[model samples]
Target: MNLLDIEHLRVDLRSRERRGAPRTVIHDVSLTIAPGEAVGVVGESGSGKSMTVKAVMRLLPRRATVGGTLEFRGTSIPAMPGRDLARFRSQLVSMIYQDPRAHINPLRTIGDFLIEGVVASGQMNRAEALEAACTLLRDVGVNDPQRRLSQYPHQLSGGLLQRMMIVMALLPSPELVLADEPTTALDVTVQSEVMAILTEQIRERSVGLLFITHDLDLAAAVTDSLAVMHAGTVVERGPSADIYAAPRHPYTAALLASRPSPTSVARPVSIPGRPVSAFEAGEGCAFASRCPYAIGQCRTERPEPRTAGTRTVACHRSDELEAVLAEGVRA
Candidate 1:
């Protein structure tokens, strides 16, 4: 079953500059996550991947204007009442943010921070929740859980704090987990360990996960499926293995080619031209300026998403591009 559904979701934020028109940071993006499945949304910085998930959690700023059908377990999220929204936020859905330090309260003890949601939601008494928190901390590989709980956020390293955040997210047994670049700030070794723990726990519980990140290889390694985004739109989406083997969209191919490999000594292949902001994109293809295969039509008309084999791609030249990419892979 689908745990989360989004269709034609658009979000416009008030411009940072006074007197400027609202800028549409997210435009007509759609995605779905099935129970027990992990889907990664991969994109460059400022590509709206984070904003899209933020919209799913209803965590966008008040100045943001949002339009879309966001459903969780067949229930409309935007239309939920205050009590339902609170329950959803606290119990049904949990988020692992990018920075653990920013999310936790420095004044509160680690134990208090970990158990607050369970206590507030009335799911467990304070003592019971505290016990559960300790168990989770141990499960996430933290040594001396009891001692760690007594300390403050400032006392722990970045990796340990992130693991704590992961434990906290799973404490509620949430049906859906939205992880926004949960390992971006950690070292490579710690990043891998944290990701492994997260993937294992979420799979054990059969919970849905929406992982957002800019690293295509990392996304492919951790997720079952991927949605490649550019300028607030999903340019391509498919099974992780297939997309990594042969991407159908130019943007997806470019991202894959940009990854560094020890066997290659050549300079990394970079996608030409900077990505356009949503407001800066014109009527035509948003990636036309950077796509080496762009034709006149690409500069004049937007391409709607079309199914190609087992995947979907939003590019007018997808068929031709797929052949080229596949041939290159074989070579």
Candidate 2:
């Protein structure tokens, strides 16, 4: 059985204005992660990557509602009761947010912040949790784990704090992790180190991961499969290598073309037009206005997701676009 399954998932947030309609943030998305597998969700900002993960974590606002199937180990996440949901969150799954400093309490020491959850969840006693934390700290290359624990969040560097957040997420021995751009704030060198530690920990522990980021190359490198999202929908999904080599969707190809290539002498080509939200998408494909290959049919008819060999693509012109998209990536 898949560790996590999301099919045709939709998210809507009720507007605050009086008598205002709810806005659809996620139109449709489908993904699955097997045990010890890493699946990357990559897209530009406002593409619903973070929102999708927020739904999985059950961290959406009170006004938010979900549709379609979202399951973990065959159990429905949306239907889980309050107590069961709490247990599921505390024991079965963990999340590493993008910013550690923002998540950690300013007044609390690192020890208080880290051990509180595990102790409250009964995963470990105080002594055992402390010991485990120190061990993880050392594993992440932190010097003098005991002293670090007593120090506050402000005292630590961005890289070290992120590593500590990773330690906290793993303390519960979760079956799956939702990592939302965990290295976005760090320097390039520190980002590499943090990712290495995170990847190593997940692999050694046999944990599943749903990694969310905008870095296409970084995501493809760390993940087995990649899902390219656009305007709150998954435009393309397949094996990382396959998608990188031959993107069927124009949006995917555009994203690949827009990346800054270190080896290539040519400057990165920017995709024309700005990205839109789910609500902004009209009658047809959200990307029609920006797609270079779009036609009148594409502007009038919404494309549904269909299988194309090893990939699932939501594009009206995927068949003919295959060669052009591949060439774009090669260029």
Candidate 3:
């Protein structure tokens, strides 16, 4: 069974300006991950990547209403009782936020922050939790685990704090990890190191990972599969190498072409038009306005996800435009 299974998942928030009318933020998003597999969710900002993770964690705002199937190991997450939900959050899955500073308490020591969750959840006593944390900290390449634990969040560098957060996430031996751009706050050098540590640890522990990031290159580098999201929906999804080499969806192609490549002398192609939120999208395809291959039909009909070669794509012209997208990338 898959470690995580999400199908046709929808999330809506009550809009105050609209007099409590619900605005959809996530629409028909489906993804799955297996043990020791890393699935990358890549998209532009406000594309519902973070919101999807929040839904899995059941950390959505009180006003948010979720729909569709959200299952972990064949069990319904939304239907889990209070005690089961608590255990689910503590033992089954853990999240590593992008910004560690904001998540960590300024007043708490590193040891206190790391040990509190495990102890509170009854996973381990305080002493055992602290020892496990110190060992994990050392394993992640942080020197002097004992001294680091004595310090506060402000005393550590961004990279160190992120590594410590990785330790916290793994301390419980969770079946899955939701990493929301965990390396976004560090420098390029630090980012690479932190990512390497994270992937290594997860792989060693045979834990599933759902990595959310906007950087396509970084996502492709570390993840086994790639899911390209736009307007709160997955536009394309497949193996990382196949999707990177030949994107089946126009949005995915445009995203790849827009990235800066060291080997390419040609200028990066800039995608036209601004991205729309799920609520702002019309009945037709959300990307129709900006898609160069869009036709009259694309403007009036929403395309459902269909298998195209090795990937699933939601595009009216995917069959005819596949070559065009690949050629455009080569140019």
lDDT of candidate 1 at residue 289, scale 0 to 100: 93
TM-score of 2: 0.98
Which pairs clash in model 3? none
How far out, in Å, is residue 288 in model 3? Answer: 0.7
In order of lDDT, best first, we have 2, 3, 1
| lDDT tens per residue, model 3, 214-235 | 9999999999999999999999
Residue 292: error of model 1 in Å? Answer: 0.3
lDDT of 2 by residue, 1-331 (tens): 9999999999999999979989999999999999999999999999999999988988999999999899999999999999989889998999998999899998999988888889998889999999999998898888999999999999999999999899989999999999999999888889999999999999999999999999999999999999999999999999999998888999989999998888978999899999989989999999999999999998998899998667999999899878888988887
Each candidate structure's TM-score, on Cα atoms with residue i matched to residue i, is: 0.97, 0.98, 0.98
lDDT of each: 0.89, 0.93, 0.93
If both were scored by TM-score, which would come out higher, candidate 1 or candidate 3?
3
Candidate 3, number of clashes: 0
